[model samples]
Target: MIIPDAESIAQARSIVLAALSEAHAKHAGRGFDPYEFGADVSPLVNAYAALTILEKEEPSELAEESSPED
Candidate 1:
């Protein structure tokens, strides 16, 4: 499995938020596309949710990677 780090998860959240904002802007004073918004934001939401669950279960696993000593 390709596990994402906290930075990556944050970036994903930013991307989803941006996309949702854009969608809202485009649909302002009009009907929005639920399908499009759902498609754009679903992955980020799912990823974040999954990360949250994982964090609760194994918080320490998210610590910084350790380097080998010389």
Candidate 2:
């Protein structure tokens, strides 16, 4: 898979936060309290952090050699 750049990463974060916010709003309207469930969202947070780390690391030589010239 092609690793995303900084801007792409930011856009993804925005999208994820927006989706989460929307879901929260929907549930709140139905009297859902997140604190009551004590649900941990760490998995999703950790996955996103891992993606950032992958983006920061140098691209694989194979990826570099295979990508078309700009």
Candidate 3:
């Protein structure tokens, strides 16, 4: 029952994407093959993933579609 402060849709999307990307890198690096043209002893496919990872973990509430007006 983790009640994360209700974030906007965009914010939630960012979190999921970041987690998936990390899992891929750790898995991908394990699968690296030096014989291949694009390979490495400690491979990395973060290719702009660092750039893509949202600077803000939570986006502004303004991203919300609609909310009950007080």
Candidate 4:
């Protein structure tokens, strides 16, 4: 299994956040596409939720990697 580097993880989060923001805009526009929301957005929402839970439960462990090493 391959581990993700910091840049990789950050890029992933950025992508997910951008997608979710677009979804939110779609939601605000009163246009909901079930197929697109399900096929495209569901997994990203789940992933972001999971990451949030992890951050809450293991803040230190997650933050450790972001710290500079000497």
Query: 1-70, model 3: which lDDT tens digit per residue?
Result: 2223434434665665676577667657788444552443222335334333434334444344234466
How well does candidate 4 score on lDDT at residue 25?
A: 85
Q: Write the per-residue lDDT of candidate 2 for residues 9-67, one digit (tens) a residue.
A: 77877776666576667767788877642253444466567756756766675378568
- Predicted candidate 4 versus true structure: per-residue lDDT over 1-70, tens digit per residue: 2335555666777888998898878875887777766777788888887655554544466567567789
Give the TM-score comparing model 2 with the true structure, all chains together: 0.53
Off by over 4 Å in 3: 1-7, 32-70
Error of 1 at 53 (Å): 4.8
For model 1, residues 45-66, the per-residue Cα lDDT tens digits are 7865765664454434544233
Clashes of each: 0, 0, 0, 0
Instruction: Give the Cα error of residue 7 in candidate 2, in Å.
Output: 0.3
Find the number of clashing residue pairs for candidate 3. 0
Question: How many Å off is the CA of 11 in candidate 4?
Answer: 0.4
Better of 2 and 3 by lDDT: 2
Better of 2 and 3 by TM-score: 2
**Top candidate, metric TM-score:** 2
Error of 1 at 10 (Å): 0.2
